[model samples]
Target: MDLVAINLIDGLFYGLLLFMLSAGLTLIFSMMGILNFAHASFYMLGAYFAYQISLYLGFWAGLLIAPPLVGVLGALIERYGLRRVHQFGHVPELVFTFGLAWLIEEVVKFIWGNNMMAYQEPEILKFALFHIGSNSIQAYKVFMIFTSMAIFIGLLFILTRTRIGLIIQAALSYPKTVEALGHNVPLIFMGVFGVGTALAGVAGVLAGPSLGTFPGMAVVLGSIVFVTIVIGGLGSLWGALIASLLIGWMTTAAASSSFQFATLLEFFGMTPPADLDESYLRDLWTLSLPQIGPILPYIFMILILVLRPYGLFGKRDA
Candidate 1:
């Protein structure tokens, strides 16, 4: 495979990882009507928690342990904190989460320190899986891909097949009606929120070694996850998936390519200024996927809002 194809695959995998973290976020915001800024903090927590667990047990065991612990934390917060704030209004609820985000980061820094932690992939999955031409595919990445796919499929099953899923769906559309129908809506909200945060935690556990366990990591990726939901359409799972993939591919492709601006200038028969800094253009020409990955989702979000206000798979009213 060419460099372009390899980069595209890399971005796609990264995007899927983002989707795992963001989809649960979309569900929480769309269903409960609260934007959780701390969602990415939970992802950070997952990474740290997994690191701790992996030290005692193993990487796989840490994966299993971290998410549930994060889920419990989320459930408690929702039951105690958010439920009380809901009596006020959406603004306070949002502010509370925003505060919670700051608190989580501070706590993380206190516990893990402000520096990036030393984390590594398991030895069994550390090597390259195969080589395609000049490109090599890592086993850890393949593991990440399959793990993400499993989570996606598992989520679909839970949200579509079970009785609780129906109730959750109903609550998203008509909370009052669901409450009136004699269901424990609050519990459902707590469960979903916990589940959602737990998913973010899982992403952290999987990504932490490669992404690093750091204090500012949550702040770095938090807004982009929100932007992913907005671009995908608020409360739409499929929309989030599509948006993630689109942003991932666009950023990766743009970063890997080196377009000749000089060719365009030559085509127009134009000349550069004698003292103009060619260094800046040289740096611009050499831009790579990782550098530009952060901004891609926001750009896609703007485009989606302008072009398709309802998003790709989002219902118009939703």
Candidate 2:
């Protein structure tokens, strides 16, 4: 029970991280119809930028500055680099982003070197926030949870209530009509793209210390974020949130449990091979869910595809 409680809290924190990154990706994809291969690269950039800024100004300042800086950089990329490729259609745009992801990785290596930075939590937030039985919950994790919740609420409000959001929705549904009505649709696309990348940047800043701030950090989280959006349904914010939390809990629960397939196989009347060392199925018999927790998202993704085809909340057309 204590383990379950601990894993639940841990999973929530991790889920928020995934939501932050996926939310931005959803916005960009919904507005621009581009699967940003460089989205996680921007996340890596955020961590590196925050780490650098934190050296001079401290963690809070890094949190404040890094995301906006990333947003501006994203805006520039959309206006100049991506916009230029847009005329050539999605294949070229995808290739552009794909090559851009590699470029960002190389640039990150050049600037930060191929090492994990000392991106520690703030001194003020270093202590345990609370405990579940013998397990202590760190203040930093609580802060991250709060930050994500705030961002989620803010995003929801912006999309549902704000004038700009209405305009964005209008542009999405009727880009030609919206433009005919005098709204700047292309500018809206650029803005959405920038905001999306910036949100990923925020997640990067929060995750860096916990996950390790390294050059390959993007590679580590990149595919998972894609899987998150896919499982949640492409371009669906609520779906992203649901899928993120589900994946988070699923992975955490799997990792925390000690259940093994061999035990289940025994219940099904399968005996362990006497020559286990040489048996082709030895690893399968010995493997635990924890050992393969990371792959659970992919499994869940395939299951979703086979069943729903679109996603939990994805539109039938999507």
Candidate 3:
């Protein structure tokens, strides 16, 4: 029970991290209808940028500096690269981002090298808060959860209460109408895209130390983030929140479990052929969530697509 509780806590933290990355992607996609494949690459950039900034300014400062830097970069990409490709349609926009992802990874490798960069947690947040029964919970994880919740609330307020948020919300629902209302629709789109990418960068900064800072980090987490957005629903923030939490808990629970399908098979009087290697069956039976964390969201995404084509909360047509 303590173990389960620990796993749940850990998973909730993980989910918050995912939310940070996915929320921006969801906002951009929901508002602009463009799927930016380089979103995760921006996350990787954030970690790298934060690491660089932290060397001089400390972790908290890096958190502040890295996100805005990434946001500026995102804005540049949208204004110059994505905007140039916009005329060709969504495919070209996606392709541009895909290529951009490749370029960013190469650039990162060129500057940081192929080896993993050492990123340490800040001294202020390095302690464990307390123990649940026998399992200890780290203060850093608690910080992450609170930070994520804070971001979520801030974003909600921006979207629902602020004037710019109102315009963005209106544009999302009816872009043509918003444009007709004498608003600068294109600029709004660009700003939202930049903000969205900035959010991902912030997530990268926060998650960098634990997730590792490496050139391959983008490749490692890129698809899973996309799967999360898809599974949650493309344009729905609520869907993304629920999906992130669900995936986080599911992955953690799977990673912590000890039961194997082989044990169940034995209980049911079933056995693999004597000639066949039982190792394969054992591997299957012993599968755990953390081991398959990246793929789980994809599986869930497919299931969601089949059952709810629009998404768990998505209203847009496929």
Q: Report the C-alpha displacement of residue 171, candidate 3, in angstroms.
A: 0.9
- Candidates sorted on lDDT, descending: 2, 3, 1
- In candidate 3, what are the lDDT values of residues 1-318, reduced to their tens digit? 788789889989989999898999999998878888999999999999999999988999999899999999998888888888989899888888899999999999999999988887899889889999977788888988898999999999998899999999999989999999999998998898899899999999999998899999988888888888898889788888988999899878877776566666678887655644556565656554457655666788889889988888888674
RMSD per candidate (Å) reads 2.5, 0.9, 2.0
Q: Model 1 segments beyond 4 Å from truth?
A: 260-269, 277-293
User: How big is the positional error of residue 62 in model 3, measured in Å on the Cα after superposition?
Assistant: 0.4
Q: Point out the worst 10-residue segment of candidate 3 by lDDT.
A: 271-280
Stretches of candidate 2 off by over 4 Å are none
Top candidate (lDDT): 2
In order, candidate lDDTs are 0.86, 0.93, 0.87
Error of 3 at 223 (Å): 0.6
Model 2: weakest 10-residue lDDT segment is: 165-174
Q: Give the lowest summed-lDDT range of ten residues in model 1.
A: 279-288
